[model samples]
Target: MNRPTSLVSALSLALASNAHAATAADAGAGIHELQRVQVTATRSERAIADVPNTVDVIERERMDELLVRDLKDLFRYEPGIAVGSSFGRFGLGDIRVRGLGGNRVRIQTDGIPVSDAFSIGSFSNANRNFVDLDTLKRVEVVRGATSSLYGSDALGGTVSFITKDPADYLQEGKDAYFGFKLGYEGSWDGLFGGATAAFGGERWSGLVAIGHRQGQEIENQGEVGGVGSARTKPNPQDRDGRSVLSKLVFAASESRRFRLTVEGNEDNADTDLLTSQGLQALTGAFNDSVVAEDRQTRARVAFTHEMDAVDAGFADSLDWQVYRQDSETTQYTREIRSGLAPPTLRDMREREFNFDQRMYGVQANFRKGFVTGGVQHELAYGLDLARTETRQKRDGLRTFLVTGVSTPVMLPDVFPVRDFPISETTTAALYVQDEMSFVDGKLRLVPAIRVDHYKLEPDVDNIFAEDNPGVAVSDISETSVSPKLGAVWHFADDWSLFGGYSRGFRSPPYSDVNIGFTNVQFGYTAIANPELEPETSDGLEAGLRFSGDAVYASVSAYYNRYEDFIESMRFIGFNDDGLMVYQSQNIAEAKIHGVELKAGVDLGALSEKWRGWSLRGAAAWSRGEGKGPEEVEVAPDVFEEQIVTRNLDSVDPLTATLGVVYQRDAWGAELAGRFVQRKDRVSDPSYYRQGGYGVLDLYAHWEFAPGARFNVGLFNLADRKYSEAGDVPVVGGASATLDRYTSPGRNLSASLSVNW
Candidate 1:
């Protein structure tokens, strides 16, 4: 592929940076990974080696150097993490931490939680991919339950994105800064560009950043083409997105500051559903086809105040923020179905599905340092208050192509129906933690607790009433308390032992608690579950870490137990109306255990002859199972209850990543490999079983001038064809369809960035 003229011009103009020399020296792959500092673990700055938890921080430099284009690329080398997406319609969907994904993992930008991921039937899906990577300064990921500190939707882990600030670009004497980057990705056939500008005076500073991208469908390794289920190629698609981020800062004094931020982004995609052709056999229609267009938009405004070195009676430092975010997802789908037997091709149906949410929140936290007797203590406390309104609507029309007449009825479904009533959720929480050090600061013990209250109010409207009459929506109020204890001991020089115990919980979601729908033609009905209980988990983890000049390594193990797992839309036998009834229920108890290992060696530190060479690797393995009650029929019309235990299919098999890197004065390169074991353990044996595979990747960066640099990556260097277990859909007996989900083959990605 030829480079665009604009990209060529930008690259030529960017040829002036000597920054790569220092980047290679300061960002050594092995040393940097070992000594990284992060803020997500405890909402305070702490070195990863000192924090009593598993945390991974990806800096902007690393993101650029690796050519990370999406969440899948961001976590490609991280063990036990994966990104799942739709088959052909909605591109990226959600991030899976350990064995849990979707709402189980909490994601936030700055201090605000991201929008939720929701799915209904087969036509609509809304995900939580709202943040643009170009505007981010750093990303922090903490694995394991963090609800004691974060709140709901954190049973598995948490991911926090910190955006860039003016201070990051402006130097001590420089009052203005400007930079831009342009890039291309082959797998997606994408073109992207972004620019950042910052200007400031002694007391005030402002920054603005904008990014845009246009791309075609992501490529895959599938060989077959054409229409219907036999087509293994990706559907034809075109996608584009734009984002803007602006910030203003004011410094009242050296110890006090205020900041205002406004950010917004919009993404759109249109796909021709060749894969959906002839899939309407159940509807007695021949030669069926579908086309879909989707749009996602988010806007947020936030204000924050911070005071440091405030020797007040109540605290030493304080931070607070107030923000509002509005997000929406809209999908429009059109289907053309031919009449049975004669094949008239006259039936046309259109559907517009939407999910919208608005949130307002205030969060405040403070830190105080004090001494009691011989023990020095650092105390942290915070409070969170938020209210959100969520709504969903499904509207459609049916038309006769011959007469060009449209009708509102499309069989079992009517136009403009809500799966669940519009609902508002309000939440309030308070949390506090105290860090105490003993043995002359060699030992640390931290204890924390959080109290949270949540209320759900539903407003049933005419659309809901007309769609599902006689159904009553219920309100809910609930409270939960989560506690945690952690300890870190510096047992010996360059060695530490750390362990922690934490509790996590998630309140029942509005859609599950008050969901109501009926399919008269299919003889089925899904009702609400007003008595649903919250899901909770208790996790315990321990690890031993060694950090030295020549080598760094860590080995950790964890075990978690979960209760009241909600299973949505589960069949509960026939109702009095002789229709199959389904409802959400809390019916399972689960247990998961895992172990992780990470190690790196800096050869230069071992000997002078081995300078500029390093080796790093990480591996993870986990197993999970759930136990639930099942009804068995011993005689006619008589059923008895029995306990059944099944493996959790979501958990990926053992995986590992390894990298070898070498750095020179102005250039560096890394060769990496990712390996996964075969997935054989699953809850359903009929589900497709994927075999093990390994892939190799190469990445390099070079600085040709004082202010310009280029980074390139060759992924899947061997052109191997393999599918991640999480990306494979359940094809059941149809094994041929599995090819459609295979990952892309060899691809090239490169970017050129400049600074002034």
Candidate 2:
């Protein structure tokens, strides 16, 4: 059936279910996820409806019910969120909120920031998907600029992953618990399994969890297969991953608690680059065999202490944590080339890359509540300090198959080059926030401010200086201040209005400020730019929320203005040596505005005739534009620079999702459809454009026996062929093999779990 027909049929089924006659007592009340508690927005526990900022919380129950196995699956139904992917080997990159992506979004696991993404050429990519979903108990997502609370790298949003604790498993009479889960997904022929064990005493508790997964290349809606860039079939790939999480907790007194946590995860992939073959026939060189092995690993150890009864009168509670994290990515590629022409010689080329980061940090916060005159106030203050060392190296070698000879093949430069000098980045921040309540808690005000300082120190080594002779790497030190104001007014029963203004900023990265690359053969060179300014954003938002017995809904609108946007490796002009010079600069100003809506209706609560029926939906629409310096050619080989305003292609088009859910005693099912509008607004007219499309998904859950449960999901029920706009390059024009980017067609996923 077509997409529209499928959706109509699903809606018809829902309407029919709603018309059924039943008693009111037989109906069940479902939990509203939008009202859940979250901590990312203010660094303190607060319900989503009470906070002035936009926050979304996904609990473990939601993950299990939806059969979520990866980042893409986790956000399958979210309207304004997306996951980025390229080709078939790079897999999933960072998560995108609204329009901005990549390094603009901040991601953390248990308060430790994830590794940054860095890419050079087409062979090396280090993404930010280091956490395993199985080990997480909940995930909190905060939208819009939030630097006042998170310091830096929170320009677009923040995602925090909270892991499971031992107390979650121990029951009233049980001191130990064990659980197991197994799952399979058809999209990649993936198989995964996990186990959890926990034990607790009166004063101490411990928990350990482990998970493993193996999968093949992700499937797409393509048929053609062979070699070269024209091939529509995905490349052959094999991937394996494992994760381990352990925690130990101790309770010293009634108001004091301590926790020690250790977590690690690693993923490895081997891919055969079938799409890279038969591209180079001019130089009598053809890629006969190309293979790449990519590996990513992350590990962290942390200790935390919390005290509620502080002796100091200024503070009522105190929390502190110290941690050390290490993350690394390594990629190795080996290629063989053969010639059918004159020389009939063969050669082997190999490339190796290693990117590593080690971080040590300490964080502390205090909370106090007091009354000043006739006003009530709750104050929160915190300090953060961290030092990170980053290093990267790229090396390669070539060997002649005919003779016993080996040499490096990097033309116009030497092998074993360092893109940037080894550097230590130190960051320190202090922040304070106060929540004031007036008129018997009907009106609330929140004011917050933060001060941050960062310094980048380059430690040049012989390997870096030897590659780029006479190049001087400069150091950078900068400080920024961010402030925010928010208000919430409860005008009527079960209804409230909220608004906020926030500021955000990101310091220039060490690699971008001191990057070095010289390619004499290509008549181009990329140099460092220590004079670049930091990127900053100012955002204003307002929303209305309603919560009632039979219905709940929320509508929000936001506008964000950004300045001094950093553009990396931007081509300026020809230098004195007739080489095109590329440097990083602050070259753009942009504005993004959007509206979001979420609504749900419980038919069971309204009347007995519609028992066990519920309806839920969400929608998002956004538009963005950027003003940047563009070169206009007035004469042959001559050009003039002009400031131009154009639509930003990073912004996703309008999207809406609707679902019908039904619940009974021991079984339930849900049907959902996601509708996306066509994308046409772009800076370049020739950029690739996609038409509107809709996809239907179905999920069912069953608890047949005590401590045993099962879940099944059928996605893309209509077998629709579509692609996420973010996954496809916008400036590449039209591609002949557009089907290569299409999402999976008709897939199934199922999981089974047991506990005792």
Candidate 3:
């Protein structure tokens, strides 16, 4: 692909410093600049401009300014990122980056991985959107491959949520402080409130927070069009959620610190399926209902020590952490059928599905800075060990008339029908990275490598094996090595050219390795594949960055090649029971490429009147393709040839965001517009293309008192009826439809926060 001359020229002329590196003067003057430091990029606190990669940070102030309602709102204006939900579902979505989503991207809070990926029949993995926005201090996103640093499941990138600490809320000389926040959303008739308390002594400090939110169903643009048009409205939902966070810090000595943290979150909702309204809706089912409950908890203990006091020649700092995390999701459903002639209760059924996962891990990191032969060098090394266990079960009971009496009976157990066996995975990794600077710090280079070994073991119960006589389940193990290299040339005082090559990989999750299903209604059976190979990718990126006191701009292009891409394949041949077989296999080689551009300016640099004004904008475009086998008929009877198609359904459309802000002493306001191009490149018959659209938003804040503030937001100012480019329809399923899920219409929200 050729580079666009206009884009290249614009980027060259408008470069500035890192997005997180603002000077004290710029801060006091309310001049927005890219001036914050981040640690996720290299596991060390450093200015974003100093790192040779594309990184985005949403600071606490920005979060408050945007009045974000959920995790999706946090990335509404970020380039190369999108959030998507399953068809006909609410409050259930996943984050996608560069066309990859699900388990391919890793999500963590405070450096601890959250939940394991799991999907059962008619139920998908619980979305990771339960974190309280009010408790977050900042969010860091790293684009492109990060497996070299984070190990498996980072084939795309990584997102880390950093929570607020006691120090963040403590006053200069105060021994304790308390804070509270209240918010309301008009779109869903939602109410939210939270309280936090922090205290600090001579040697120890602690912070605790509790938050809760309740809401009715989210409103959307009226009914969808097509066969299932009647199901246009989302299922009726009533949700209640709560979150808790607590942390304790002890300064044992001038050079050492210890911290303990605990966090918990829960979301419960009741949904009315209303299944009788769709084209293939249940004919006789009535009063259908579903209840979903999801919970997550984590506890961690960590220690950090500065080695300078001990005269450790090779080490400047050392850190170690141990943590345990657990998550569970349970869904229950009930339905009544009355299709008989007498209209009597013909059938009553109750079903439940439960999934639980637990993880334990420990990690250690050491950093050393030194000079070798006139060149400055910084070296970092780390080791990680983790173990995960997962279990899933499904059960149902049906009542029918027997000898003129209604009696409830248990359903027969079958392989892949009611339950899945327990599965366990253990992983160990070692990694090292070195940062070197030469030519009086004008040229910098970073080289890193990681080695990982993982084992997957499944303990299938006798019931499943007995039901499916020929099925075989066994243990699988694999090892992978990833390497990365990056460099930056400071060609000018405020300009730099940067590039890097990185490798990433994703091991098969438990669901893919041991998944088995026998769908009698669909006349197909899916069996587990113990020989699945891990997916791997090699990515190359290059870009130029300009960082000036008043202007910041960057443009980067990246290409990624992937191998052993795992995809589900269907075979025509039937098993002994006359059922078609579908299995996941390494079926394709793929490639993805894209371009990202961002620019921000403090207008005050141009005129004194614009001292408190700034403008910011970002745009991204990406495309992907893969070669895989397709069951196409050439002569109306035979099928052959491998075809090329869009590699992943999550490929983002051309998206852009532009905004203007004015901030002064105690008052601030912002206006922003978001746009997405139409997506028609789909080649798969199982998916639908999304149309393009744009929306505008407005926000304002006022600090009425020393420790109090009020904020208001007006979303979808134009009240446009549209769907996100990533909101494609799920084809050929119960929830299948030709219409896309429309976003919420015009909505209003207000919040008040106070501290003392």
The number of the candidate with the highest lDDT is: 1
Per-residue lDDT for 1-756 in model 1, tens only?
A: 111112111111110000111135533444645467888877777787778888788788878988877888778888877787667888887887777778888999997999998888788999999989888989888888888889988888998989999989888999998888999999999999999999989899999999999999999988888888688899999999999999999989888989999999999999999988875656667556799999999999999999998899889999999999999999999998876545443778899999999999999999998999999888999999999999999999988887788888976898889999999999999999888889887898989899999899999999998988887788989898989898889899899999899998989999888888887788988888878888899999999989887777888899988888777777788988898988878877778889988877778877778888877888889998777666556677776666667677677889888888788878888888889999887665766777899999999999888778999999999999999876875455348778889898999999999988
Off by over 4 Å in 2: 1-31, 281-284, 340-345, 574-578, 635-637, 731-733
Where is model 2 poorest over a 10-residue stretch in terms of lDDT? 12-21
Model 1, which residues run further than 4 Å from truth?
1-23, 26-32, 341-345, 631-641
Residue 158's lDDT in candidate 3: 89
Judged by whole-model lDDT over C-alpha atoms, candidate 2 comes out at 0.83
lDDT winner between candidates 1 and 3: 1
Q: On TM-score, who's better, 2 or 3?
A: 2
**Tens digits of per-residue lDDT for model 2 on 1-756?**
111111111111110100111112223344354467888887788777778887777778778888888898777777777787787688998788877777778899888889888888777788889999999998888888889988788888888899999989998889999999999999999999999999998899999999999999999988889988788889999999999999999989878999999999999999999987775755658889889999999999999999989978879999999999999999999988887454435778899888999999999999998998878888999999999999998889888787857887656547888888998999999999998988887788989999999999998898888876666888999999999998888788789899899999989988778888777778887778889788899999999988788777888899999888876677778888898988878877888899988777788888888888888778889998877676666577676676767777777799888888888877888888888999978666766777789999999888888878899999999999999876776434567888888899999999999989
Poorest 10 consecutive residues by lDDT, candidate 1:
10-19
TM-score of each: 0.95, 0.95, 0.90
Root-mean-square deviation of each candidate, in angstroms? 7.6, 6.3, 6.0
Q: After superposition, how far is residue 209 of candidate 3 from its true place, in Å?
A: 1.0
